[model samples]
Target: MATEWLGLHFLFGAFLIGAVLSRGAGEHLPRTATQETRQVTLILLLPAYFLLAGLRVDLSALDPSGFGELALVLVVAIAAKTASAFAAARLHRLGSRDLAVLATLMNTRGLTELIVLTVGVETGILDGNLYSMMVIMALVTTAMAGPVLSGLLRPAGGGEQPFSGETAAHDEPLPARHAREETG
Candidate 1:
């Protein structure tokens, strides 16, 4: 709400603060304070966040007359995200398989997108039909991530387990430098 006064999304403000504070993972806090914070997040914040997201998207609010527009939005959202991620991964010299994996994952409208969409609806930036279309696009793209990435990242011979870290691809941990790069 305070951020809205400055014409910034509240989530973006929260994200900026979190990014700065998370740099040291709250080393200034006592261990019990850290543990309690995690507990509160898990026990209260997580469920509330998801519940808010779920409640904001009412499927019946979708306009039957807007099917064509919805279809176009979904197609463009998925295609644009995948193509951009694929191009970026290729530029990074990722392997062909990894490129596909990156593209598939990039298309997902995860919690961050959901939060923004909910905020849009709350702030009247989105009307019923438009919000419905956006929500549908987000749902469809996110739903595709697991199955699509599984197929894209699978190893040869197809015997490896799907999403189990014990698979051949996960046989060895990533190098420390690579892990650091990924985390950063």
Candidate 2:
């Protein structure tokens, strides 16, 4: 109804309706039904969504003239996201491995980027060539996130502490005395 009547994107409308419905009736849903819905969404709907997005992509719009600009944009986007996340984590005194993982995750531009790009094209805010480049950028950044996070979180020489609660160097369990002092 939002999509047809209000000119909103189908994805956006569905998300808004789902959020509203969940707030009102999520706890009333049976656990099994929720689990099955999640499974179906993941196993079927998500793949179809990506396939449709890929089919809609216009590869012919990727011209050599804009290749350099696209590359620069991609680099800037990834770097800015990672750097900002890393800096914020540092301010919070997150461990090195945790900081790296956070930065890598922050660099990912996945479904949200696709939604924005789709809307931009629809509204004539981006030309086909620019839209294609941004889509490519989003794909590359999202694809890189997993591998980069694994590498960053991997222990070096099997000596480094893992980022888990039991092993994190900077996140040791607080002594009762210190905890009381801080909280009191």
Candidate 3:
């Protein structure tokens, strides 16, 4: 209601509401509840949103002359995002595997990118061809995150466990004891 009244994008309004709600109630939420919410959001809402975005894409608007521009955008976007994440991870003294995972995750464009592109198109900041290119770039970069992280964080040998001790190699999924301590 507030979103429509203010002429705000639905995604932006939803994000704002989520941020506020999380700030107010996140810690009180049970871990399993949070996990279930995330799983449902990913499995249901995300695919429908992306599919809608894809359907809106005007494939006929793609110009052959724009191929170079598209490639440039893709390269620059990926490089800039990954490089920034890598630098930040390095500054934090994270391990090589941790750095790779951080960078790959940070580089993912996902739904946020689609939301931005949608706004851009609606506002006349981007035409059909540019929007198409950016959408493709988002999809490619998001898709790369999983494979890249898996390759980077895979166990060094068949005998090695993926995680060990109080300080695992990756930054995500904090050691169980550490997580409990933090939560408490």
Candidate 4:
């Protein structure tokens, strides 16, 4: 089981790394590929992955305690990520649109969270129901990001910065400007 999980992780990691390297190389393979092809490929891969995941779930020794722990972890994970996104947005002084984009990107778990839960189940670290909850948590949190950010960015009145001043971070000051102070 461990070896299978490791192999799966390695394959996923390799795919992600390959994507990053290819993107960095400015390869335009996707541009050449038709939109229909891209859509079909995604549609096919998603169901296959989800089906394999569902098949792997083991439901024999279900426990109730794990649910509480899973809930706590999910809450913490979502809160921490959301708070960090807001903090980073403040520090960077991002506009409403950019902050929303950053928050959305930061909240994205993609397949990574699912992969982690899958590995936990395969390794016997987490039971099936617990794993399912984690999967649900991932889905819910990932889905909420878009709507939450949109709501937060919606205007109430006159123009004001979307992000609060509380978390605003400033970079290093300009030494040249500081040194060349007014002589008057």
Candidate 5:
């Protein structure tokens, strides 16, 4: 853990801070400005980071045991996290959409997982093969969250699915155009 803290931890910490701040800013900013800025930033920055990380990966020491361990870790991670998310969402009375988004975001280990794996490999706590397995686990677990949550939460769209007959259909739009037309 100490070694993991030293090597590449700062990179992920910085990334987390950046993501939080940017997302917070987007939430507060005008929709058009937020969309434009996010698009530009993602287009400019994401590919470069992906390329750099891919180029740095060591692929020589592949191992079967590591793969098995990775599978186990992924199973545990998803089961534990999904259960926890459901509990938390219920406790907070989060709407289905919000709960889905929260679940997806919580599963996104991203660069943080990579940093820990890299540190383990660098410090000999984990071999290259095991590190690779950890990376794979992180990616798979993170990627599944969105689709899973979406499947669970998505409405059929025939009508409003009431949340216990208490919550209103908040996303329903007002008849602004019809009102204007009638007034005019």
Candidate 6:
């Protein structure tokens, strides 16, 4: 909450609180705590946030110029986020397929971006047109993740299950970890 005094967004305050709590309660959190938290946050909270953000978007505000600006924003955002993630992931022993998946997934920037944009509109930092454009940009960029990942991961043969874990994900370690959890 103190972040507002520094002219920062309240999202920073919430994020800071979450990070501090997670760090403090790392050992104290029960086994299912993480799973339960994830389920609640993703299944329940995220959709509500998205809906609230969607309500404020005025489609009429997006004229030809706005559409052009939206296009440019999408290109810059997708390229920047994907390239940075790809470069960072290159340090690992992942293959091209896994790297593409990881990089694309990292570009999923919806909730936080929307929250900031919504606040910007409320605070008059963004006009109605810019808010609509930015909101659409946030949505479109995040929305591309699923189809893009499917395309990147899809086999040339167009199989139902595109790739196997041991191969596509290079997730050999997950199997071992799950096996340990099952018996223990």
Q: Higher-TM-score candidate among 1 and 2? A: 2
Better of 1 and 6 by lDDT: 6
**Candidate 4 wrong stretches, greater than 4 Å:** 1-8, 16-20, 24-37, 54-66, 94-105, 123-129, 157-184
lDDT of 5 by residue, 10-119 (tens): 55567576776754655767899978877987997776765655554554565677557767878887667767886787565555565555666667776677666665
Ranking by lDDT: 6, 3, 2, 1, 4, 5
> Residues 1-184, candidate 1, lDDT per residue (tens digit)?
6787898778877877777775576788898998998999999998898787776666675566577788899889988998999888666556566667778888775676777887788788987677767877888899989898777656687855343222123343235435766899
Colliding residue pairs in candidate 6: none
Which candidate would rank higher by lDDT, 3 or 4?
3
Q: Which pairs of residues collide in candidate 1?
A: none
Q: Give per-model TM-scores.
A: 0.75, 0.78, 0.70, 0.58, 0.52, 0.67
The residue-level lDDT of candidate 1 at 143 comes to 93
Q: Model-by-model lDDT, in order?
A: 0.74, 0.76, 0.77, 0.65, 0.63, 0.77
Off by over 4 Å in 2: 159-161, 164-181
Per-residue C-alpha lDDT of model 2 across residues 131-159, encoded as one tens digit per residue: 87888888999999977767776677655
> Residue 71 error for model 6, in Å?
1.1
* Residue 160 displacement (Å), model 3: 6.8
Cα lDDT of model 2 overall?
A: 0.76
RMSD of 5: 9.5
The per-residue C-alpha lDDT of model 5 at residue 88 equals: 81
lDDT of 6 by residue, 1-184 (tens): 6988888878788889887785557667786997898899999998998788888888786778878888898888888888888786666545577678878887787877888898898778998887888888788878889899889877879865543323334556445645776999
- By TM-score, the best candidate is 2
73-158 per-residue lDDT for model 4 (tens digits) = 67887778767886887565654456556766677884787777776787689776777767767777888877776666666873
Clashing pairs in 3: none
Better of 2 and 3 by lDDT: 3
Query: How does residue 32 of candidate 3 score in lDDT?
Result: 95
Candidate 3 wrongly placed segments (more than 4 Å): 23-45, 158-184
